[model samples]
Structures are given as C-alpha cells and as structure tokens.
Target: MISTRKKLLAASIAALLSQAGMNSLQAQEVIDEMVVTTVRMSEPLLVETDPRKPRQPLPAHDGADFLKTIPGFSVIRKGGADGDPVFRGMAGSRLSLQVDGESVLGGCGHRMDPPTAYIFPEAFESIQVIKGPQSVQHGPGNAAGVVKFERNRTRVTEPTVAIHTSALGASFGRHDEVLDASYKTPEFTVRAIGTNAAQNNYKDGDGTEVHSNYQRWSTQLSAAWTPTDTQFYEITAGRSDGEAAYADRGMDGSLFEREHYGFKGSIDNVSTLVSNIEFQYYYQYIDHVMDNYSLRTRPAGVTERAMNPDRETRGGKFAVTLQPFAGLTWVMGMDAQGNKHSDRSSMNMAMTDYRNLLRKRDAEFSQTGAFTEVSWDYNTTQTLSAGVRADRWSAKDHRSMVMLTHMMTLPNPTTGMKRDDTLTSAFVRLESQLGDMPGTVYVGVGHNERFPDYWELISKESAATTSAFNSTDPEKLTQLDAGYIYNRGNLRGSFSVFYNEIKDYILIDSAFRKPAAMMGMTRVATIARNVDARSWGAEADFTYGFADNWRAELTLASVRGENKTDNRTLAQLPPLEARLGVHYDNQTWSFGTLLRAIGSQDRVDIGRGNIAGQDFSATNSANVLSINAGWKPAARWMVTAGVDNALDKTYAEHISRAGTDVAGYTQIARVNEPGRTLWMKAQFTF
Candidate 1:
C-alpha cells in the first residue's frame, strides 16, 4: 500500500532519476547552445515570454494567445482554444497562476480550463510576469500578479545530449508539432516534452462561419539531480489531452484530461543565517468533459447531454535565502494549498454514461502560508525592498440541494457549512539609478487580502443561512506600482504605472432574473456582492536600434475601471491598446513587422461579467497587420514566416463569452477574432 503521498512520490522519483555518473565531457558544445531566442530584450513591468522564442503572427494556441503579446495583456476569445487572460483590471482568481510551481485547477464551472490550459508554450523555458501585489513568494491571494512557467536547469560543462524540434503550419486547417529532449551525465538530467495541435473553422471578415474548432495534446517529464556541487534535485511528470469547440458554451469541450506531479529541492552553501535552501511539492489533476452532442450539431429531439467534472490541487513549499552580509538579503517561506471538486452527470437521452452517474462532491479548499522577504543594497544606485505575508483560508460545502431545475430544488446553500479566513499581505519597494543615464527606477507598494473563489464563494452568491460559503467580506487591496527602464546607446525603453484600491469589492450583480416558470429559460444569475472599486493603469515600451541592420518597436496599453460602489464602469475593462514594430537583421536573414491598434469599449452592464467576460456596447476601432521572416539555413536549421490578420479584421473581444444562439445565431453573437492567417515555423537542433 504505497500511500503516504505515494511514498513521497516514490522517493521523489528516486531522487530525480539517480544515476550518478561523473567525468569530464563535452558533447558538441551543449549541442550548439540549443538555439531558440530571437530577439528578447524587454523588461520593466517584468516582461519575459520566451516559450522557446515564439512570437510573431500570433497563433499562440493557448496561455491566452501567449499572454497577448505582453504589455498589460488581454485575451478572452472562446473558440479555437481556451482563451482567457486579463490583467491590470484583474480577473478570475486574481491572476496568480503557476505551472512549474503548481496550482493547476480547472474543472469548468464555465472556464473550460485555465492555468494556461495545461500550457504548451514551445515546451516552456520562460514565461514570467509579476506586476501588482508586487511579490509574495508564490501562494496565497496575489491580487493580480504572478504567472510562472519554467522548466530550466541546464548548465552542463560536459556530457550533453540535446534535441529540439518544432513545426507548425497555418491558414485555417492549422497544425503544429514540437518535441524537446535532453539527457546529460555528471550527476543527473533528463527532459522530455511533446505537443500536437490543430485547428479548423475560421472565417470572419464578412465571410462568416465562426465557431472555432480545436484539438490538442501534451506530455512532459523532467528529472534533475546533482547530489553534490551544492545539492539539487527535481522530478516532474505530466500528461495532457484534447478537445474543443465553443462559440461560447452550451457545452462543448468533449473532455480534456490532465495530471501532473512535481517535487523540488535545493541547497547551496547553507550557513551563516542560512544562505539558499528551497523546497517544493506539487500535484494537479483535472478531467473535464462537457457535451452538447460531442462538439457540435444538436437538436433533433435534444435530450442528449453530458458532464463529467473533476479537479484536485495540492501544494507545498519551503524556502530560505539569507546572506548575513554583503548588500543584505533575506527570504523565508512556507506555503500550502489544497483543493477538491467533483461531479458526474447524464441526461434524458438516457445514460450512454458519465459512468452511469454517481459522483458528487462539490468543493473543498484549504490554504496556509507564512512569509518574509527583504533585500537591501543601499549603495550602487540605491535599492530596498520588503515583504510580509500570512494566510489561513478554508472552505467546505458538500452540496445537498440547490439544483434549480430537474424538478426544482433549493437548500444546499453551503450545506454542512465551513468557512474560515485570516489573511494579510504586504510589499514595499524602492530603487533608483536614473541619474546615470543608463536609467532605472522602481517603486512599489502592495497589500492584498482577497478570499473568495470557487466563483465568489459557492457559485456567485445567494443562499444564506449564513452560507454561500459564509456571507462575503474579505476583499481589500491597495496597490501602487511604478517602473522605468531605459538602456543608453541605440535607445531602448520601458514605462509602467498602476494604482488600485478596492475594499470589499467583489462585485457581479447581474440583476437577478431566474424564474421563467422554474427555469425554462429567462436565466440570469450572477450575485456576489461587496462594492467600492477603482483601477488605473499605463504602460509603454519603445525600442530602436539605429542602423547596423535597423529595428523599431513601440507598445502601449491602458486600463481604467470604477464603480465606487455603483457610479458605473467597472465590469470587464481592457481597451486602448497599440503595438508597432519593424526590424531587419543580417548574417543569414531576419525581418519583421507588426502593427495593432484598438480602442473602443462602451462599458455597459449587460448580463454583467467578470469570470472573464461581460460588458459590451462600444465597438468600432480595430486594426491589424503582421509580417515576419527568418532563416538560418544551416547549423541545425531554422525558419519562420507569418501573415496574421492582415486586414481580414472582424474583431470581437471585449472579454467575450455569450452566444449560444447556435446556428441561427443571435444571442448577441460576438466571438469572432481569427481570420487572416498564414503561418510557418520550423526549428531543429542537435
């Protein structure tokens, strides 16, 4: 009975695939540095995005179109893949997503799958962003910040074996493929990654026919161990599945299974107030399936439905980093998380099975945390930082009623009850170096205390006997962030700003409307109270590389929200955007072009929205144009190409979602975005 967390995950994957081999070696120079990094030079509001160098003509199948080209990000299209990402004006679990560091929950309470939908960003290696709520180590409510996706640990000086492959094609019957492999000697190392992608049904810009199609696949495994040279260990496992089709729900995901496990360890030097030590443990699982005639075409008697939901989350963490002297540094940590959810269903077409139905668990949650941080280097251009955190949240509700149909029910309002909280967070930052011309600046302040999820505590409000998971209360946030970065010679740039204030804020009132004779239609339910809100934002980036092969770039973003408890205008924000680019290179080719512009948001209430959608009525403003080219021609090959949305514009993305007017359409339609395409990608390495 290998229990006990499966015997510590099989002794941490046997200490990360122990093999213990040691000898000086060198294999083709780490296989020519494993190529993949074509222009990455931006940082301020912390911009990373390096999914093995992919960014050109947006076909980013997931992770919200690869975080919408960075800069305050935006995405909420629901068609070809699970699009959903919005930052600055925050959304969902208040941002904070993780992948190499756990937290991967998604069993569709209407969100097909978030957590970057089981990520597949060119087999990950970079993807980081931490904007607001400054930093809190990595757990607990982060108040719109953090998005990690890492898989790195390759620093070999001998014995190496590496391989990377990529292929992609586009223009409506899109296709993609990827594989990554690694092996090393001198302690331990192993890596693996795989992916498959697909697409179909795309036509817009006056050609009609939306309703996107999709297919996906994934696999992963990683191992690391050093046993010496300062100690280190790691183990990872992964799995992924596919499904798609959704012009905005009435079911259509057809199943997407996933599972992952991780174990981490580290130690370096370790002495004098302790210097460097880290730990982690993780687990994630999800099995989803939603049906409306398996992907499309329904209605011939209708009575055919299906549902199979699942979710599980687990976590752990431990950290230490102290430098008793020299510029000072300290970090301490402890983290914990837990999650559970379950479901099963079948319908009138009589069971063709959801395993004959019998699985109901409805929510359970837990959280724990403690933290401390400090960094000081008051010399060399000044720097200072601070941090603090504390958390203890809990939840439980095992459903027993509240069905709302199938013969009307209503009681479960958090049946069996259980709710708890005790939160706290903090941050502080300051830095300077502006006077030296190389430019640099920083300022930060953050505080977060959010507690309320699982759709604002038990499916968006209503149902109290003191429970909808306990009458609200716990939102508070205060933010102020600032940034600036500039590089001299040949010019480069960055700028950032933010301001937020939210107290109690937990909005989403949809204005009731549930009884249509006990629900035959008329539906509209959103509930979740608490008000007072405010948001503000700004961003900018610029680049130029006069001659020597030329270059140009510019980006800007904006956000604004308000609803100081109902003065209106704070439901699904994100508008005013811009992007521009141009480039040229030498030594075997390179070229680029980009242009994007947007602005137009009416900000209404309409059925309300925020689990990633809602607010429409201001539409107009749109533009697009793209171009790319690259070629290495030798040295393990490389190729690139593009042509995206080049005027095939048919926009629609004000935080989408809505439109189950199926074939005859008209539920306000809207779910376009994806038309002019023409892609090409190829990569290889030995």
Candidate 2:
C-alpha cells in the first residue's frame, strides 16, 4: 500500500541523493564560503547544460508539462489542466512569467491558472529562460519571452532537513502526487511544498470519451535570516486550490484560487576589494472562480444551470544593483500592478434558488513601471548589455450587463475591440567572446508598447469596447534577436534567431454571431478586430557527455506566424518540434529516455475564415516516448520508476480543444497523448 504519499516520496529521494553527496562534500569543506561579488555578467549561468549533469524530469501532464523539453517550446492542450506556452510564435500576454521577479498572470480568460501554476520543480533551485526582447530587467509585458523560477539559499554548516516524493500513473485514469520540504539552520531557513493531480475520461485515437477531468493543490512557506556571511533575509507564503472539467469550454474551473506573499533582503562586501550594492522587494496575490457546475450538459438533465466568476490580483517589483568599477555594471528597476473582476449567475435546480436567476458584476486594472540597465567588460574577451523601459497603464468598467458587453457596442471579430492607450518601451544589446572562436556571439533590438486586457477590453462587441481595446491606442512591437554559443569539454551548444513586427495586431473570430436566450435566459456575445502581423523563429540546444555516467541531449524548435492581412497561418503557431535525451547516473542509479517529434501543419487563414477555414492541414504527425528510473539505498533514501507512451502513439496538439460530436470526431482529431503510462517514486532526508 505504500501510501502516505509514497512514504513521503521515498524519504525525499533519499534526501536529494544525500544532498547530492553533500554538494560534493562542501567542495572540500565549507571553510569561508563567503563569495559575493556582484553585477553585470549576462548569459553565463546555465546551472546544467551538462557538467556533472544528470538532468531528466519530463513526462509531464500539466503546466505545459515539462515545458515541452524546452527549445522554442510549445503546448496548448485543453484536456489536462490548462496547457498554454507557445514561445517563438508567441502566446498570451506575449509570454512573461516570473516567481522571483513577480508577475504570474493567468486565471483562465480561458486559461485556468497557467503561469506554470506558480511552479514547484521540487521547490526550485533554478529555471531561467529569456528569449526575445533581450531582457529589460524582468517585468512590464516582456515582448514574447521570459520565464524565471528561482529559489536559492541553502548551505548548511550545522542544522539540516529535506524531503521529496512522487507517484504517477497514466492513460485515461491518470494520477499524480508530490511533496517537498527543506530546512537548514545556522540562523534560520525553511521551505515546504505539496502537489496533487488526477485525470479520467479519456479516449482518442479513433475512440472518443474526452471530457478531461482535473484536481489540484499547492502550499508553500519559506523563511530565511542569515545574520552573517555578509547579510541576508527572506520570507515567502503561498496557497493554491483547484478543480477542472471541460470538453472545450462551456464553463468549468470551479475555483482555482491562489494567494501568495513575499519579501526579500540581501547585502554584500566582506573585505571590500571593490565597490558593491544591491536591494530588492516583491509581493503577489491572485484569486479566481468559474462555473457551470464544474463541466456542463444542461438541456434536460439540468443541474440548475450555474455561472459565477471572480478575480482579484495584485503585484510588485523593485530592484537596484551597482558595482561602479572593475569593468563596470549597473541595474535599476520599479514595477506595480492591481486588478479586480467579479460576476455571478444562477437559476436554481442545484444551487438552491436565490432570486430565480441572478447576475453580479465588477472590474478594474492598473500598471506602473520604470527601468534601466548597463553592463560592460573589455577584458576577459568583450561583453556588453543595454536596456530601457517605461510604463503607465489604467482601466475601469464599473459594470453595466457590462452593456451587451463587447467593449460596450458594435462589431464582432471574436471579442477584442479597442480604445485604452498608454505605454512605452526600448532595448539594446551586444555580446562577444573569441579566443579563436569556440563560442559566444549575440545581438538584440527591441521596441514594445502594449496596454489592453480584461479580454482585450470588456470581451468586445465594439464602441471599440468603450474606447478601450487600444484604450484609444496602444499596441506596437518590433523585435530582432540573434544568437550563437558553443563550448567543448563535454560539449554544449546553442543557436537562436527571431523576428517580429506587429502594429495594432489584434484579431479573434471564434465563429461570429449568436443571440438566443429565454429558457432560463443567458446570452452574452463578442467579436473583435484590428490587424497586421508577422513572426519568425528558430532554436536549438545541445549537450553531450559520453562516459562517467553517459549523457546526451538535443532539442530543436521552429515557429511561423503570419497574417499580414491575408497572408495565412497564425492560429496558434507552434508546429515543427523535436526533443531527444539519453541519460544515466552512477553511485546508486538513475536512467532516462525522452523523445518527442512533431510535424504537420495544414495551413489556413483563407482571408480570415468564412466556410473557407477549418482545414488545419488535416493535422497529423506526432511521436512521444518516455522511460525513467532512479534509486538510492543508503545515505537517506530514494526510489523512482518509469514507462510513458512507450508505444501508444496517436498525436494531437494545436493548442488543444476539439471533439464536437461526429462520434466526437476522435476527440478533436485525436489529440490525446497519454497511452502506456506508469510511474513510481520516493524520497527523504534529514
């Protein structure tokens, strides 16, 4: 029965592989360990692209599941806890998610708590990704890129404790569970995390059952205070809840509330050999709710039709850094946010009558910002970094049916009319390293200005959504990025390319026209507009280490999005994909297998639809496979198992959501990718 969360996840992977062998025995005993010399050193912190590496933990089912094993990254599935992350071709809010840098927007605007569900990569140690817009100090609508999840600070010289666990089973009725804990004291330190997941109702590959089930959980706590070694302080708090059901939306998200708290502190300089300075502050909160009795069927077997929506958001950011000399460095920042939304509906039958059928409402939003950056190094082989940012945003709707909502009157392209405006942005970059070419070369250019949310402005219907989609005007983008990196000595590589040009680009047309309500009345329509677009992409990541525990990895990505008026494509761009892996570890055991290949797009954009759309190029071509293993006996405890897909392939991924009868059309042309699954895990350390 090994329950109790698999005996506390095998005592937390036998105490993180005995703390990864006590971090290789404190790199020869932690004597002084007070190394803090700040600032300016862009790109060069890839904890593990390979180097005593052992990476492997992707066979995901949620949170865009293991980020599609990185590359350009892609995911838009609907039947497994909200999936959405299409970088390269871009996705929602131009992709920007941070944990240590605030901003984590996602509460189902048909999204359901995305933003990697507030992360839990075993209580993070690091996971940073920055693609386009080249970094403006993390925050303020990051033009199609940026991902950060960092939780560092743990170096026990005295007290210590740790734990982790896992259990998984897949195929239709899937299940998952995880738990994490940490504690280290010389002064103080603590951490805790928990997670749970479930799945059922699955059938694709010609057989349909699709209805996607779900359940979720999260909890976190952190505290740190180091009286010396320079100085330090930290505080964190968290809470999360979940529920899901949808066969392509009609309503269901039941209640996915999340509330988080934060605080941080730092200081450095022990024997000043040069100048230094640093400071930071952060905060967050989010709450959401949705309904239709969780899923929906209402026609005769009514469950008293229901609908209730709610949202509340708050954000923060602050930063400063300086090194003043020795090759120079500097950084400065500021950020702010606020939001609110509310809605209600009911017709008694299961929610117990309350004034027959009621509808409630609320809305508001705000943003503020300031930024700066600089970095230089002429010796150690040339280095440079540059940046800029400026922002001020606002919004309000005060409620009215929100008024046949649709931005308060006229036109429907799908829901996104414009009017609201106020934004500013800028960027720059350059990098080089040539001791006779072995790696490193880069360039960047950026310009962005955006302001429009709350469904691009009251779910649109036009007065341009009350003079607010563009809030009167605010939407622009111009970008270019280039890259190359290499290393030998066990091999490591990178390649990147990107291009974007968008001006007033806003389009949504999910089948226009609809107005019928009386059998318990409820009709709210939408249509949106604005156009001009272009997108381009390329990505590659590599790693190799053949021996002393074998290893190999390769990832490739491609993207294309267009709509230069009547150019085509662009309906969730994210096709061409690839992933490969082979790993093995010693001194106990660890094994792996990961391979994913996807290709096949049918091309569309017949002048933006009208019986000429819906070809998706007959979508086809998908391969996925996985296998894993881990075990550690003494030194604390650990265990892990595997088997995923392993020969049960039938693909579907186009941002997910399909299956509207015709025998459910193979659940949306068969896009269920979970068939031969199984899993096991355990861990603990103290």
Q: Report the number of the highest-TM-score candidate.
A: 1
Residue 640 displacement in candidate 1 (angstroms): 15
User: Between which residue pairs do clashes occur in model 1?
Assistant: 25-158
- Candidate 2 whole-model C-alpha lDDT, 0 to 1: 0.59
lDDT of 2 by residue, 299-396 (tens): 45445544455566666666666766777677776777776766565545455543354534445677878888777886787777777888777776
TM-score of each: 0.33, 0.31
- Give a tens-digit lDDT track for model 1, residues 79-191: 77888788876877888888777777688776777778778877887888877887888887779788888876755767899988888888888888989988887688888
- At residue 357, candidate 2 shows an lDDT of 40
lDDT of 2 at 672: 60
Which candidate tops lDDT? 1
The lDDT per prediction is 0.74, 0.59
lDDT of 1 at 427: 89
Candidate 2 displacement at residue 383 in angstroms: 8.9
The TM-score obtained by model 1 is 0.33
